[model samples]
Target: MKILLSTLAFISLAVLLGLLTGGRLSWLVRNTTALRLAWLAPLALIFQWVFFELPGMDRHDLVFAGHLLTYALILPFIWANRRMPGMPVLAAGLGLNLLVILLNGGMPVDPGLLRAIGRVGVYQDLASRGWSGNAVALTDRTLLPFLGDWLVLPEPFPARGPYSVGDLLIYAGGFWLLAGLTRRPAETEAPLKPA
Candidate 1:
C-alpha cells in the first residue's frame, strides 16, 4: 500500500512538473490507449491480494504457487508497454523483483528494517505462522538480499521501511513515463469534410 501510494505521489509530481513546463495531461491520457495488455495490471493486483494478502486462505504452498502466477500475469503488461518511456526501467525493476521473489520464496523483508519502520509484526506473523503470502523475512539464508527491499525511506516519506531497488526503479519509471507522455501534444482528430 505504501509503495503504491508513493509511486502515485511521484507520478503526480511528475505530471505537475509537466504542466508547469507547458505539457498537457490530456496527451498522457490519450496516448495510454496504446498501452496493450493494460487490463492485466488490475488482474495482477487482484491476484496479489487474493494470494498474498487475503485472510483465511488455505495452503501456504498453493498461495506461494500463486505468487509466480501473479507475476506471470503482470509480465505481459510490462512487455506490451515496453516502448513507452520508463517501461524498460520498470521492466528491469519488475524482473529484479520477480527473480528475488522466486529465489527467496517471496519478496524478502529485512526483519530489522521492518522493526525500524514499526511494521514487523504482521510480516513476522506471516513468516512464523505458515501463512502463505509474498514476503519472506530477510535472513542470512535469504538469496539475493540486495534485490529485496533494501532502500529505506527516511523521515517524511510515507513508508519508513526498506523498499526495493525495483521499487525505486518502478517509481522512477512511472514518473518518467508520466512526464514524457505529458510533454507530447495531444492528437486532435481531423474534422470530417462534408462527404
Candidate 2:
C-alpha cells in the first residue's frame, strides 16, 4: 500500500542519514535511556490489540499489526534508554492516539477520505459478504469535531504524499526528543588536577 511504501522510504532515509553521519545521527537510538523506554511503545501497541477490534477480520487490522511490529523492533532501544528524557512525550503521544481510537470505535479512519480513496466499493463488498457482520457502519459526519475528522493535507509538493498537521507535530516531537535523548551528556570538568 501507499502508506507502507511511504514508511519504508522514511525509514530508508533515516538509516541513510545515520550512516552518512558516521553514527553521529542524534535520533539513532544509540543511548541507554532511549533504548529502555522504547518498551512503552510496544506495550502501548499491545494495548491496542487487546482493545481495538471490529466484529470479524478486516483490512484495518493491518494498522495494529504495523504498530506492534514497529514498536517491537524499537523496544530494545527504549529498554536501553529507560532513563531518557523523552519517554514522557512518547507516552503522551501514545495516550492521545489511544484516546482518539477508543473514542472512535477502535479505528480512526475518515469515511469521506476513505470514499475519496475509492474504498466504498470495498466496504460495500465487505458488508454484502458479511465480512463485517456484527460491526456498525461509520461515517465521517458522525465523527466529532474538526480534530476527530481525519483530514489529510493535500500534497504540498510533487512526489510527496499528503500528511496531517497532527502527523507533522508528532514526527517533529518524536525526532526532537529522540535527538535530545541520544546525544551524550556533557562531561563535567574535574577541578584541574592539583599541580
Candidate 3:
C-alpha cells in the first residue's frame, strides 16, 4: 500500500513538473525510446514488489533480480541517453555499486540489522534455501563492500530505519542527473550592436 502511494505520488509529481516546464511530458512521450523506458520503470517496480511480497519465495533471488534490473538494464538505458547532462554521475554511482557487488559475491545484506528489523524470518527462510549470507544478512559490517549492501542506510536521527551510504549516493546522483536532464539549455546571445 505504501509502495503504491509512493509510486502514484512520483507519477503525479513528474506530471505536474512536466506541465510547469512547458509540456516536457509530450516531448518525452514523442520520443518512443524514452517513452518505452519510462513506462518500463513502473512495470519493473511492480514486479519487484511482487517478488518481495510473494509467500514461500526466496527473497535473495528477488533482491538479486531487482539489482540486476537496475544495474544491467536501467543503467544501460540511462547511459544510452548520454547526451543528457548528469548521465556521467549516474553511471559513476551505478559503477560503484557494481564494483561492490562484484567484490562481495552477490548482494550484501547485514544479518544483524535484518534481525533487528524483524526480517529474521525472511533471512532464515532464504538462508535455509541456500542463499548466500551476503545476500540475506542485515549488518553494516557484512554489507559494506557488496552491491546490495550499499542499499541499506542507517537512519540519521537514530530512529529505527536502515539505509546505506550507497543509497544516499545513488539518490544524490539520480537527482543531479534528473535536474540536468530537465533543464533547458541556454540560448546563444546575438552580438550587441556598437553603442
Candidate 4:
C-alpha cells in the first residue's frame, strides 16, 4: 500500500512539474507509449498482484519465488530504457533493491524506522513475529542493514511509510525523467554534430 502511494505521489509531482514547465501531457503520453518493452512493466505488476494481493496468496509456498520474480521482471524493462533521461538513477535504485533482496531473501524492515513513522503496533508485531509479507525484520543477522528500508516520512505528510534509500532513488528518477520530458524538444535532444 505504501509503495503504491509513494509511486502515485512521485508521479503526481512529476506531472505538476511537467505542467509548470509548459510540457505537454501529450508528449508524456506519446513518449511513454513509444517505450520499448513497456508491456513488461504491467506484466510484472500483475505478477506481483497475483502473488501478494490475491486472497490466500500470503499462505502460498511460492510467495517467495513470486517476490523475487518481480525484480527479475522489472530490471529488464529498466535496462531496455537505460538511455532515457534519469533511467540510470532508476536502474541504480532497482539494482540496490535487487541486491538487498537477493542477499537477505526479501526487503529488510527496521522496526525502529517503523516506530518513528507512527507504526508502533506494526513494529511490535514484526519485532515479535519476525516476518510479514515480503519483508523481514531487520536484525543482527540482516546483511547490509544500511540498504534496508530504514527511511521514513512521518506524520502530516500525505505520503508516508518505511522505504529504503533505493526506493527514494527510484522515485527521484521517475520525477526527473517525467519533468525532463516537459522541456522543449530541442533542449531535451541535442543537435547532431558532424564527427
- Best model per TM-score: 4
**Which model scores highest in lDDT?**
4
Kindly list the per-residue Cα lDDT of model 1 for residues 1-195, writing each as its tens digit. 886896578778999986787778676665655567778988988898888667775666777788888889989888767767778888888888988988878788766666667776655664576232566778788898989876777788886657799877876877777776666633222211111
Query: Please, what is the TM-score per model?
Result: 0.82, 0.49, 0.56, 0.83
Query: 1-195 in candidate 2: lDDT tens per residue?
Result: 565576566555545644464444543443423243445565654554543333343554554454445445554544444344554455445445444544544334444454564557535643453223112234444343332325454554222322334345455545545445334443111111111
190, model 3: CA deviation in Å?
21
All models, RMSD in angstroms: 5.1, 8.4, 8.0, 4.1
| lDDT for predicted candidate 4 compared with the true structure | 0.76
Q: List the candidates ranked by TM-score, beginning with the highest.
A: 4, 1, 3, 2
lDDT of each: 0.72, 0.43, 0.49, 0.76
lDDT (tens digit, per residue) of candidate 3 on 1-195: 644664465456655654566545434333323322455445655665555565555456556666566455565465455444445565666676666665554555655556666556645754565354225443445445544642433543322324445655655555544433333332101111111
Displacement of residue 57 (Cα, Å) in model 4 is 3.0
At residue 83, give the lDDT of candidate 3: 45
Candidate 4 scores a C-alpha RMSD against the true structure in Å of: 4.1
lDDT of 4 by residue, 1-195 (tens): 766776787788997888787888776766666666888888998998888667665442366689888888988888777767788898889888878978887789987777777777667867876655667789899999888888767576655767798988888887887786665545443321211
C-alpha RMSD between model 1 and the true structure: 5.1
What does candidate 4 score on TM?
0.83
Q: How many Å off is the CA of 154 in candidate 2?
A: 2.6
lDDT of 1 at 182: 66
Clash number for every model?
Answer: 0, 18, 13, 0
Better of 2 and 4 by TM-score: 4
C-alpha lDDT of candidate 2 relative to the true structure: 0.43
